[model samples]
Target: MGIKAALSKPFAAYVHQRNQAWMQQPAQTQQKVFTSLIQKGASTAFGRDHKFKNIQNHADFTQAVPVRDYEGLKPYFERVKKGERDILWPGKPIYFAKTSGTTSGTKYIPISADSISNHINGARDALLAYVYQTGNSTFLDGKLIFLSGSPELDEVSGIKTGRLSGIANHHVPGYLRRNQLPSYQINCLDDWEEKLDAIIGETLHQPMTLISGIPPWVQMYFDRITAKTGKKIKDVFPDFNLFVYGGVNFEPYRAKLFESIGKPIDSIELFPASEGFFAYQNEQDDPGLLLLLNAGIFYEFIPVSEYYNENPRRLRIEEVEVGVNYALVISNNAGLWAYSIGDTVKFTSTRPYKVVVSGRIKHFISAFGEHVIGEEVEKAMHQTMQKFPEVEVVEFTVAPYVSPSAGQSYHEWLVAFAQPPQDLPAFRLELDQQLRQLNVYYDDLITGNILSPLKLTPLPSDAFQKYMKTQGKLGGQNKVPRLSNDRAIADALVKFKVES
Candidate 1:
């Protein structure tokens, strides 16, 4: 191993020891975080308005602060944006992680001094966990690339404001600064395609070892690299071995990604967001992400089934059960109180609290009461792809087709394929069957003639790319939703659809 890799051993060992302390007593760690958050928040303006002083326990907190989304939290956020201090957190946030919200057009999430470590250390620990477990820190010796939003910041209330990834760019440890690639100037490019091309130019022949980004965008980078050199990524960067990704499930893009790489490589998954860095995969073989309970954030969960109720029951960390889908709610040092970030997750293990992001709370298909979720469809797609190796998918999405041109209504699946199946009809039928096995509601609808067998709408190779470009979400942290209840995205894909 190189000097850097050898030096990481001691640091990795230290991180493992520190992590073990909290992992062994997750509930106690969370209680401490909860108590600290309440104590600090009690001094903020929002705390005063919400009666935070009386919040002696989780039950009291629930009563004091009802769960809210971006819209509900905007009142205080607006004040913070206008240079207000102690509005949300203890004082003016060091930065505002600006993000595009579905209902609220633009959002500015606070990043206070106490909370910044959560984002920075969470990512750092994910890497250290890999080093500690496998004892292979060779990747640290070479160049690393993190496909991210522009690092360029716009000032708001005298505070730096930008995308979460952009904000994170500023916090990269000094040791990694020389090892990171695609130069700051290239990263600051406003357009994604432009930035991607620039990244390829800069890292094309570098000794790259680690690549991190959302899966789809990383696939795009891989595709561009291969297309440019007429060689798989392995040939271009022989040492490239580790992939770190978050935002979307990697299963859907796994086949394509590995195909581009020309071989399987190790990867670490992270659960990060504008609000906080929540979890990361601690073991190479484990699919679950170890939730961070001591990250200056108090977590809560409302069963997805009860998320829309008049008063959904918010359960503490200890109250959550394995395998149950829950809308993740959090109160963090960033000044968010009982905030729902819209993502849903299922616990794989409760002993140390590991979870898998199941889907988005609002991104589901239930037009005909089927309630098909992202996990179900993703599983169906993954199984069908495994069964039909010849069918290489680029991207796909599902939507309820309530009004078809003819016959009974059915579910519509828009798929952009890298390699189309030889037997299109068979592929469609097998995919439908897989979905039926996963979701009884969808199966019942088809059985009772409430809907027809799902239809497959082939899309051009560049369909999703074109769609994302049109929506101004072409790259960076933005991603296409896997499924939606309404036809917004489905209808948008119509123009790019092709005859199968």
Candidate 2:
């Protein structure tokens, strides 16, 4: 075996051992770690003499604290915006991470020392697992390229941070950080054009082994790389071994990406958000296993079936059954007790706790009462795209648009295809039919005459990227809003008239 291959085996074994050790810990041990943090947070947020002792010990902790969306946290975030410390937590947080909220525009999320530790440790564990699964430690040791957001911190006052991705990039171990990359590649600290230019320049001739980021930004990076170098990504980074992506569904964009890079699907799906790095796909072969961050937070799963019921049933991590969909609720050190992050997931197994993201609870279009979710749209699109063997979908979004008349709505699909379909109408019908059959709610909406017929728009070749640019959201953490229910969605659709 080559020297690289020889090094890989033991590295893989070490990673597997560490994962097994984590998995073998008793439930009580994990719970205590979470409980201790909650106690500390409670004392810090409320007074030390507060009535609530711990998250699990207090019913008021659950009942009094209403499930909050980002908007609800605006007041606390405003404190960060004013450069105030100890607003969300007791001490001065290490930094703030600016993340985009659905309706509240942008938010400055606090990232404490402890939260940064969680992110680093989570990333380490994920990397260890990747080494074990791929049996390739060379990639781990080689230049790791992160197509992250700008590292620019705010020039004016307030908590002064750039994007969340940039903040996290700053926290990565300095020893492991690459040198050839642009000094300003840090998203939380630089201007957009300079940052993009730096990223392109640094990556031009580098032997990148790992690439990580959201799909859209990565796509933009590769597109620019190709434009600048007059070469495809594979030619530029032939040594690239792993593609790590998170923050949005990557299924639609995967085909085009692989084609562009001429690489196999050795990609890792990282389930991270501003809240925390929730989970990562352990083995590339299996569906992602929820490597519960028991050290950071207490977890509870509410059955997906209970979402609409009078009283929803929630289960502790130990109580969750295999093969059932559940919404996640977390009690974390950040002073969030029994907090529902509004994402849905389904357990594939119990022993190791493997799960698939079912959908986002709030990111669906149910305006006319159809209740279409991210997962449903993903499945329908996947199935429909499978029928057209030659075509590849690069980006797609669905919005519920109302007709000029009041109380009339329909599903409008905006799709950007890498290769145009030979039979566009048939493709649209197939997709619509798949959705209608997948969810009875959709059928009920249509049959009850509450919604107009499904509409499809084939966007211009550069539609999505242009849209992103127009919004000042061209890179890093911004994802194409997969589903939108806002009135502005209809207005945005006007920019791209129905394909001729």
Candidate 3:
């Protein structure tokens, strides 16, 4: 191992040991975070509005501050954007992470000085945890590339504002700066294709050991690398050992990624967003990400079944049960109080508080009361593909097809295939069967004749990519939603469909 890897071993061990202290007592750690958040919030304008002084405990907190999405908190956010002090947070945010909102046009999530460490530390420890567990810090010796958004920032009331990834670019640790690849100028390029080509040109001959990005974007980089070098990614970057990814589930893209690399590699999955860095995969063999309880964030979970209820019971860390889908609520030092980030997660392990991102709360199919989530669809796709080894999926999305020329209403799956299955009908049957097994509501609808079995639409290659390009969301944390309740996306996909 090189000097950097050699030095990281001892520090990695120390960090791992420190992390275990809080991971073992998750509820206690969370309670401490809750107390700290409440104390800090008491000094903000939101605290006065919500009667934070009267709040004593978690139950009191629920009563004082209702769970809200971005729109619900926009009034205070607007004040902060207008340079108001102590509006939502204790003071004006250091930066506003501008994100695309579904209902609200655009969201500006605040990143306070106190909460920035949580974002930076979570990412750092994820790597250190891997180094501690596997004694594999060799990647530190070579180029570590993060395929992220532009580092450029515009000012909003004198505070810097940009994409969360772009804001994070300014915080890359000093030690790793030497190993970080793709010149800053290339990262600042607005067009993804241009930035990608620039990234390839810069790193094509470098000793790239770690490449981090959303899986699809990374796949594009891999594709470009292979096209340029006329060799597998493994041959071009012989030392590349770690593939760090977030934003989407890696299973669907796993096969294609490994195929391009010509071998399997270890990966670290992160559960990060504009709001905060929530979790990171610690163990190489574990699929569950270790939730960061001691971070400056207090977490709550409302069961998905009860999320829409007038008074949904918000469960604290100790109350969460394994395998139950819960809408993740957070109150952090960043001043987002009892805020619903819209993501749902399943607790896989409670001992160390490990969770897997189940789906987005809004990104579900409940058109006919048969609610299906992202996790269920991804699993069904994964299982069906396992049986049909030749089938290679590029991307896919499901939307309700309520009206059909013939027969009952059915869910329509639009799939872009890298290698289309030989027997499309058989493949569709298996895929439908797997989904039915995973989701009982879907199964019941099919059996009750209320809905027909799902129909598969084999889309032209690059259909999803083309759609994303058209929407100006081609890369950098932009992903196609796995489930849609309406036909908007499906109707748009029709033009890209392959005719039988």
Per-residue CA lDDT of model 3 for 91-149, tens digit only, reads: 78999999998689889999999989988888999999999999999999999999998
- lDDT of each residue in 303-377, candidate 1, tens digit only: 999999999999999999999999999999999999999999999998789999999998899988889999999
Global fold similarity of model 2 (TM-score) = 0.88
Q: 381-470, model 2: which lDDT tens digit per residue?
A: 988888988888778888887777743778888887768789988988888889988889997777787776688888765678777777
TM-score of each model, in listed order: 0.98, 0.88, 0.98
Q: Choose 2 or 3, whichever is better by TM-score.
A: 3
- Name the candidate that leads on lDDT: 1
Candidate 3, residue 381: lDDT: 98
